[model samples]
Target: MSAQDDVDDVGEFAALLRALKERTDRSYGSLARRLAMNTSTLHRYCAGEAVPVDFAPVERFAALCGATPEERLELHRRWLLAVAARRRPRTASAPEDEPDTAADPPPLPRRPWYRRRRVAVGLAAACALLATLASLSVLPDGRRPAADRAPTAGPLASGTTEAKAPDRSSPSPTPSDSPATEQPSASATPKKKPSPAPSARTTAPPRSGRKPAAVPLTWSANSQAWKLGCGHDYVIAKPPRQVPPPPAPQDAGTWAATQGAVHGGETLVELSVQGRSDTAVVLNALRVRVVGRTAPAPGNAYAMDQGCGGAVTPRSFDVNLDKDRPIAHAVAGSDTGVPIPAVRMPYRVSAEDPEVLLVTARTVTCDCLWYLELDWSSQGRRGTVRIDDAGHPFRTSGIKGLPQYTYDTLARQWTPDS
Candidate 1:
């Protein structure tokens, strides 16, 4: 497979899983039986053909392999990394599907980028929306086709009921074209409903036996968009046609606060954190980027260690720049924050909730200010968010140039309210 396919197919996590399986000294068939999964599926997982969206299979595989606590932890870590890499754009390098012959000359060399151009946003509005248009399939005559029309919902006592009208687009059939038909017999056997699959999140069954209603189709959490209404009885409502939403602003919810003069190239924002009262709030990429005056700093503004110590660095805090994972979700945690990692220094981040960064005033002792030339991206759009100084506090809430930004203490990230 090509490098393109390799990134999606043979990512680091999947590679580790395959190695573990080999070391376990079990055949794919044996592993499948133990895990209660299909042999082909086990093969896929080992081959790195696909990653199971469900982590249950992975955990089971690791357990079967007799993984130790440390090994198991590593597996989980790689799994997360693999999951994240899968989520990210994978056009890092060109694909090399076909190998060149020995007789062929070598390919030309490629140069690395110094200052990079902006990366395009991922699928902006890829939402799952259903558009159920009435699929009318009737005869040209004012009557609907018996065989062609789906079994109608809500059955009556005995005699047949009138079917929905046919498509208006079809030419109407005259009396001469109409076929003689008899009413549906009450004795007609009702087709048996295939049992719902083990993993299905079935919608409520057709209105109890008395009156059969259109089976309200719903997609399972584990299912794809195309696998709609699987394993159901006579599907009353066909799978809904998906309607893609209109394009959203490519750079929605991504900004950086800069300080230096806007000469050319990318924009820059100012950063100033003085005493406890006037210290400017530090925000995540989606919120703002603080730039320095004379010299640049790794994280904070000019001076460095504010109430937070010098040992404390931006990396210490959990950094969440993925636009889709908003700061709001992180704030849902308690204000006290996940306290387990605070002792480690600048911050403590829970593996379960990487977005949640926990830092306390106790950890940061120095009373100082910082200036930073920030760099970060949110959602898909990436750029330095430019905001002019209009005597307004270049704080968490900047002037008009930047959108409404909110800093979440619990999650330790910036959220673009507007």
Candidate 2:
């Protein structure tokens, strides 16, 4: 299907996912781990703000939710319809009772009293009376207005001179002066040189001061933990995914250097704690540092707060290179990347929350990717940190443009890196 079709399918695709999620009754965090993605990202998919790019994730998610094979087929069918609808023209038919404004109305003939015979006769008499009065004004016009005849030869392009209102800028020319005015000389030098072209410093004011609640990234010194304060961004936190599947070890370097650098791509720095299912993993701190510069790595962003209005938002950290960043940073603004300062892991999954290690590696360029390495110092028990799933150091986009040199996971194509 076309790219447009995929975007349009967001709503229906999201609805099905929402229902599937409820059927499983799981938390976003649990599900993300199960799906190998971020809890925040899964929320976006289910909220209709974004659609699943890879059917693999969707299929796996469905199976985890215990969706019957037939039900899964229906999900796929609806997904296809939603995507197809996107490509379909939104033109709607007009109501049968409504008039079609496209057609022109018949022209009306202009008729009035001034065009009638009686009115015409009355007008002629009035003109004759005005002429007689004029001829008699002050004894045949005391100095018979000096022959108002216009001069035929003059500098004026249209030579026949006519009466003109005097210009207010300068005193009216004395009658003795020659009527012809001289045009400027070609020898005269040019006036002020056009101001130099504006510099790059002049940019559309950076989008700021307009903040829809930030993801209340809180750091409680006493607790030594990061907490997501209650806000619209996290109103109803979708349960974490079902028991997570085995990890698919991806090469952070190969993935980031090739795919993460796409001009309009997205990268997610997902987190997975090291612990048992019932253990509550508290995050200490994570930094998105720019250690080196890589060629062609321009500004990009991490997708957040798109639809997180009142409920707990998904925790899947996604980066959309196409979206603008919130702040004015040197490399990429909000799109540049996210800096989840020292935050406490305040969310608890279950009674058996055990510490788990998030596997990660040196992924893509700092400019295009946000590799989050967690700190386990604050946890009651040092939780193992693993970083292989969703929101890894580097993740691909749902949809990507024709890549000049970057890899497009959707297309499974790219201009092989040098």
Candidate 3:
């Protein structure tokens, strides 16, 4: 058979196998054993990777699947048509003296409906005669009419073209070449439903010091815009505070006082303890990336490590920069006599309750005058400061361009709150 014929058969076979598998809960192994075939062979058949041209295996598969008898017969009919579609007859002319050597006889012309009825009637009459002769035990009967006995003649004899035969006592079985009348039986097995397939993605892991499971942050691409929704809003200080080192001890060893200012705006920041913090970070990092797009001019990514040594349980905390924070001192100047305009840092954080926080309103100064003016509320919380340089506002808030800094005890990373 041709290659095209092979593909059609395999396609039909695959359909049959899938249907069977759907109807029966049995796996490939079970079906293979039932068919008395090798598992790999059956697998290839179902996969459409086996023989290219035969429908025999396909019909076998349907039969083993308990497909209805009519379906089986119809399959055979289709197979014949497929074969005929691919068959190409040789067209070379034969030698003049040689007897005709055609592989198949010329197709008979179709008869008109009335003519077909007459021809069928004549055939029935001939069958009657043949049956009668066979029943009589006429032993190699040459006694039959020469018309019926002619070597080249069929059911309609040569000389009897104008006449039809009389009915005989014996009845002949219908020709095997004629179509059958039996309807196929219904399938005996009860129908079954298919099961759902397993998922491919993995689930999130648990975190420390937390009650509920951590919610991992998710991100998706649409067209151009990105939207961020976090557990808490971020703060964007008015004029971002200039980062500075801690002040030196003056009198004896009195610890320096902690002082800082906050902002109220569209941006916000998140600050949390370590061990339990990783969970929230992972869960909401993606949201931060989405909403924190108002980047500083000439933006650059940077990291800061403010060790909260021995003070907090865990040693360090780090920030996940969607892009990066601006260098506060360089951009917003030192927080000495005047509080430079703080850079707006937009961010999102995940927590028990989520809120948006903004940092820095107008200009906030560091204290030598011992007081600076500031508004810190967009962070879902509120705070105010009127300190005029208590010798240094910059000293407390800006270790790394951040308005405030915190130390993570669990993970050793520094986090800045702007």
Candidate 4:
């Protein structure tokens, strides 16, 4: 079948799965064996004949196929849509010979003539009694009768004159002339009711001095350009010639993720931090925490960009990953010519005003698995937030002696980095 026919048959989610699998150039049996799944079941997933009960298997499959982060997100979105469609109920047509039971409602039971007449007479008498009571309760001017109104109290015994009862024959006093204790006229504007006090259950408690379980700060990581016009370097298993051309600036992360790349030598991570609420958060310090250390993975280093020009003077920091206890030191910008002062911590961030921290983590001795801990304080509460790649520690490796490659725009191919 044609590719278009297959897509129509299986669906968007399955089509994406098939495409990612094809890009890896591995047989279904080989990939399925690695995934620890039945080869036929894997084929069913790719063919759109079936969907996995959970996203875990799908995510694993995508990771094995080297699908980019962007592609994986898209895959997830399409999977949700497919799942919803599968669960949606389908309308079925009735058989032509079947009776149309719902076409007409069941007829109501009929009453005898004498019984119906008796019910009508009883309803009329009750309605008439209600009308008479309503007429007697309200006066012609919309005031209640004197007998129906609450009795007013006499004057208090402080040598004050006793209060006299209102004359029954006289019309009720206008709102302006009415006594303070009297009800206001119906035509007068109604008074607004005071709002009720909030209950303890509904009221939010004040922020305490105790630290919260989670920090209020939120951040995102992106691969940023380094000094001397060099962009991010990733170590991939593929040779220079076999790797694809350089990706655009915005697509750098997706490209790196798709190539199953690892940071080479140094990785410049741009951390965008902002408070989760309108309340400002103070960033006290950032500490590097190494999770694991091992020999650098063997692979060829590919630079995302080479020989590009331009410099950016942002709030930047430097960390030597080789140290047992690495500290992020505030650093001056490189290639900007002017001596820019390093921006020390104690930064403030809010929902509206965010802070960006450019960190250059370098390693020359060993491959490192590390993350950052940002100490922040806001509203009398202080806590530390763990920063990593999604939920995993960021990985970087030393590439001192590894072969390096860069894409050649003119040759339309990857060439050895000069």
TM-score per candidate, chains pooled: 0.26, 0.24, 0.19, 0.48
**Ten residues in a row with the worst lDDT in model 1?**
222-231
lDDT assessment of candidate 2: 0.29
Candidate 4 C-alpha error for residue 241, in Å: 2.9
Sort order, TM-score high to low: 4, 1, 2, 3
Q: Taking the tens digit of each residue's C-alpha lDDT, what string does model 2 give over 1-418?
A: 3344445556767888889899876898788777656676688678865454224466668889999977777776665455333322233433589543222112122222111110000010111110000010111101111133111100000101111111235332332321221211110001111111100110111123232211111110000001111110000011112111111111111211222222123222223232222334455544332212222222222111222222222222222232333111112111013332222344332212322111112223222222233333323333212121111112222212222232233554432223
| Candidate 1 vs 3: which has more TM-score | 1
Decreasing lDDT order of the candidates: 4, 2, 1, 3
Off by over 4 Å in 3: 1-6, 52-60, 78-418
lDDT of each: 0.26, 0.29, 0.25, 0.52
Task: Pick the lDDT winner.
Answer: 4
Off by over 4 Å in 4: 1-214, 224-230, 334-336
Using alpha carbons, what is the TM-score of model 3?
A: 0.19
lDDT of 1 by residue, 213-332 (tens): 221111111001000101011111211122111111110001011111111111112121111112122223322222211111112111101111111112112212222221211122
Tens-digit per-residue lDDT, 201-275, candidate 4: 001111333321334555554433343223567777777766788654433444554565667888676675766
Off by over 4 Å in 2: 1-9, 84-418
Q: Residue 103 CA error for candidate 1 (Å)? A: 41
Q: Compute the lDDT of residue 101 as modeled in candidate 3.
A: 20
Every model's Cα RMSD, please?
Answer: 28.2, 35.7, 45.2, 32.8
